[model samples]
Target chain A: AQTVTQSQPEMSVQEAETVTLSCTYDTSESNYYLFWYKQPPSRQMILVIRQEAYKQQNATENRFSVNFQKAAKSFSLKISDSQLGDTAMYFCAFMTHVGGSARQLTFGSGTQLTVLP
Target chain B: GAGVSQSPSNKVTEKGKDVELRCDPISGHTALYWYRQRLGQGLEFLIYFQGNSAPDKSGLPSDRFSAERTGESVSTLTIQRTQQEDSAVYLCASSLNRGSLNTGELFFGEGSRLTVL
Candidate 1:
């Protein structure tokens, strides 16, 4: 079994500033995928970014980027030029192949991010 | 639909009552997932469906929770004799299954919030 951890329960950032949410996971498998998802007040879970275990380069999507440290088992999300729209609960997830064809995602506890104006 | 859709965005029911939540995955998606998100908590995997394969019920918390997917399209999650602990946001997601290695990023629905009183 795999588990993900988010040390921060809540975070706040000012508009136009940058903030980073930390995530770590415990997995014995060498091949896997990591993801960050954002859920807003409207209850929609939106994909933020993704990182593959074999890839050395991190993933970046516009203002959202990730610092994936494979050896240390850390994958943190960085939000730049934060806006009010970024205020939401962010979750880090870990996925790996199971039973040949099954794929399961294990998620960490979320971090509530509030981007203040 | 252009995106994953979940019905009964908000459901309020008393304890001991049965509740059903529906999910319609993205067109052509071969994989569908169910997750539970309690208030101020992270997402927890509930079940998974891939094509016509037997669904993965390993993540289900108990026998009270059950889910079914017809073909590769709509899915319904049912909670029998729900408890107060059953009150949470039920999220549905879908993704393209490329192979055993890459399941691709999941696209999520707005989720169905169940409030048990």
Candidate 2:
């Protein structure tokens, strides 16, 4: 079984500043995928960024990027120049590269991020 | 619609009552997924369906929770005798193909919020 852990329950960042949310996972499988999802007040789950375990380079999407350390089993999300719209609950999820024939995801508890003006 | 659609955006039912949630995946998507998000918490995988194959119901919390997908399109999640603990947002997602290595992005719906009193 794979388990994702987000040690921080709550985080706050000043507007226009940068913030990093930490995530760690336990998985015996060598091939896998790591994802960060955001849930806003509208209750919609949106994909933030994703990293492939085999990729040595981190994944970056505009202001959102991931620091993926496969050896350490760590995948952290970084949000640059945070805006008020970035305030949301962030979750880290793990999936098997083999596909959902296994049909499941292991998610962390979540970290509530508040972007203060 | 361009994105996945979930019906009955909000549902409130008394304990022990049965509730049914519906999901309509993207037109050409062949894989659908169901997940639960408790308030102030992360997502919990529930079930998954790919094309016309038997669904992977491994993530369902209990036997009381069951889901079905028909014609590789619409899906419904049914909870029998719901408990107060069932209160949460139910999310649905879909992807083009599950077997492909490029299946990284998942389109999500606004989610159906279930309130069990």
Candidate 3:
């Protein structure tokens, strides 16, 4: 069983600043996928960024990026030029590679991020 | 038609009552997922359905929680004899297909908030 851990329970960043949310996972499988999801107060879960374990290059999406260290089992999300709208509950998730009955995701406890203006 | 849609945006029921939450996945999406998010908690995997195949219900908390998907379209999660612990936001997500080592992005619904009184 794979478990994702988000050590930071809450994080705050001033507008236009940068913040990183920590995440780590326990998985024996070398092939997997990691994702960061944001859930706003409206309760809509939105994808922030994703990284494939096979790819050593980190993934970037606009202001969101992930530092994926497969060896360390750490995948942290960095948000640059943070805006107030970025305030939400961020979650780290892990899933096995494509074709399998175990395509379900394992999520971390989550980190509440507040971008203060 | 545009994205995943969940019904009963808010549900309030008494303990021991049965409640059903509905999810309409995105058109043409072959994979659907159900998750539970308790207040101040991360998303917890409940089940996953791929097309018409038997769903992976390993994440279901207990036999009391059951889900059904018809024609790989809409899915219904039923909680029999609900308990206070069942109160949470039930989220539904859909992806293009079963995620292998390489998975596609997951589009999520706004979620159905259930409150057991």
Q: Output the number of the DockQ-best candidate.
A: 1
Least well predicted 10-residue stretch by lDDT in candidate 1 chain B? B96-105
**Which regions in candidate 1 have their CA more than 4 angstroms from the true location?**
A98-102, B100-103
lDDT of 1 by residue, B35-54 (tens): 99898888889988997554
Query: Residue B19 deviation, candidate 3, in Å?
Result: 1.0
Could you list the CA RMSD of all candidates, in the order they appear?
1.8, 1.7, 1.8
Candidate 3 lDDT over A1-117, as tens digits, reads: 899999999999999999999999999987788999998898888888988788999999999998988889999999999999999999999988644544888899999999999
Model 1: per-residue Cα lDDT at residue A54? 86
lDDT scores in order: 0.90, 0.88, 0.89
| Model 1: per-residue Cα lDDT over A13-114, one tens digit each | 999999999999999998888999998999888889998798999999999999999999999999999999999999999988544443778899999999
Model 1, clash count? 0
Candidate 2's DockQ is: 0.58
What's model 2's lDDT at A105? 62
Deviation (Å) of A83 in candidate 3? 0.8
True contacts kept of 3: 0.71
Residue-level lDDT of model 3, residues B55-106, one tens digit each, is: 5788899999999989879999999999999999999998877434225568
* TM-scores, each model vs. reference: 0.94, 0.94, 0.95
